[model samples]
Target: MLTHPMPDPIAFQIGPLAVHWYGLMYMLAFILFLVVGRIRLKQAHIAAAGWRYADLEDMLFYGVLGVVLGGRLGEVLFYHPMYYAHNPLEIFAVWKGGMSFHGGFLGVLLALFLWSKKAKRNVLDVYDLIAPLVPLGYACGRIGNFINAELWGRVADPSLPWAMIWPNVDQLPRHPSPIYQALVDGVLAFILLWIYARKARPRLAVGAMYVLMYGCARFFTEYFREPDWVVNVLGWDISAGQVLSIPMILFGIGALYFSYKFDKKAAPTNVAKPKQKHAQ
Candidate 1:
């Protein structure tokens, strides 16, 4: 871990077109998903749903909308409803900052539901296929947060090597919550979900594990994250991230349970077997 005070957000500049690292990170996240998703789709389980490589493009296109719109909306509604109500113009200034992970999660769910209906595909099947590819993008998002240095962490002991002293906050060393999230949510999440999804059995497993795993990671990680300035409630001392993660953990628990219980239902018993399109 080198300490050069986290790089500046700018990637490069083309006259007035100044490219930000945050934006670049999103592009990279999506590319990683595209590359990984294409390979996974060809697997026997995904093939059951007849997802072609082309489908990845269409599906991810919808996801982009979900992430942007839902994230921005979630921030406004969940964290700063009162403030935004006072300053309506700030709601449109997403590039400046403010987005909620839970909101974006909801957005993607809706997008997938619509995509499933239009494609005549089972909703769970698509969810399972897409779950593994999500972590990389999420990781990239955290990296963006780090670069912006907006979502700083709680106060920490100076002896803490990884403790970051965000001048905007106090000089005290503090946990770099974004980095922790990137490791847990981004790196660990991708590895675990990808390995688990290789076979793609039990459609519920993928979506459920995604909720469970990310929720757990996020909930725990939120402990070190600083509270949003907008909400300074007493006693709880918990951040909004932790509150949002609770539902995800619950949903994950339910999903995994059903996946196990219904594992027998999707079996090839009189019901039609999944078609094999790719002979290879």
Candidate 2:
């Protein structure tokens, strides 16, 4: 028989501010991004010509807006369109929880595109730079899910050694999907991006790699993840994540091919030499 381990969502409280573990995870994620991003700014390629740390600061601000708004809207539309439409006010209750990764991803993509355009940067360069910084935040979100005991996975067979019953899900022996996601989507993806992005190349490759890797990981994991209350099945009884991932895989393959073909040469260091003009 399975049982629930109900975790305390609230970590602590400071006066009137109720500090939740999920919120604390978010704070830690942000701090990690700041630390990593600053280090990235000092890299040779970033220090050269036009890229600057200020760009990173600007990007963080815009990215937050994109993630929060896009994630919330995605959850409302993709998962519970009917419920939210009927009770629209519930859409803004983000603190109550319900954000989608796909939505947040789209939001981040759009935000990066806009930032690249404004700064006159190779869009992929910005993407490659930020890719490594993303996964930890995602992992943190999964931790939050675990703390809240939401998004439990499918039932396990009786006598399954690792099976657990989440108290939040009526104490059913469901898979710990958050932990799985934390490993593959959060930790593994971070390692891949962190290793690949440092290469000296046109940035499209890494950006595409990030998308492809994330799509593959998420698509595979969705099998274990429970479907949204009002979502699933497209034409042939498949998950929404699988449907969304197909195009990403294609794009990733294309980008990787091109990066290898055109930008294989190692990127040069940023050391500068003063102009020595010919005296006429």
Best by TM-score: 1
List clashing residue pairs in candidate 1. none
Poorly placed runs, candidate 2 (over 4 Å): 1-4, 229-236, 261-280
lDDT of 2 by residue, 145-194 (tens): 88788888888775877788876666567777888898998999998788
Report the poorest 10 consecutive residues by lDDT, candidate 2.
229-238
lDDT at 277 for candidate 1?
A: 100
Query: At residue 85, what lDDT does model 2 achieve?
Result: 92
For model 1, the local distance difference test gives 0.82
Write model 1 residue lDDT over 140-236, tens digit each, in one string. Answer: 8888888877788877777787777786666777889888899998899889988888774676888899889999999888878887742345855
RMSD of 1: 7.2
Off by over 4 Å in 1: 1-7, 229-236, 265-280
lDDT score for residue 114 of model 2: 91
User: What are the lDDT figures for the candidates, one per model?
Assistant: 0.82, 0.79
Local error of candidate 1 at residue 83 (angstroms): 2.6
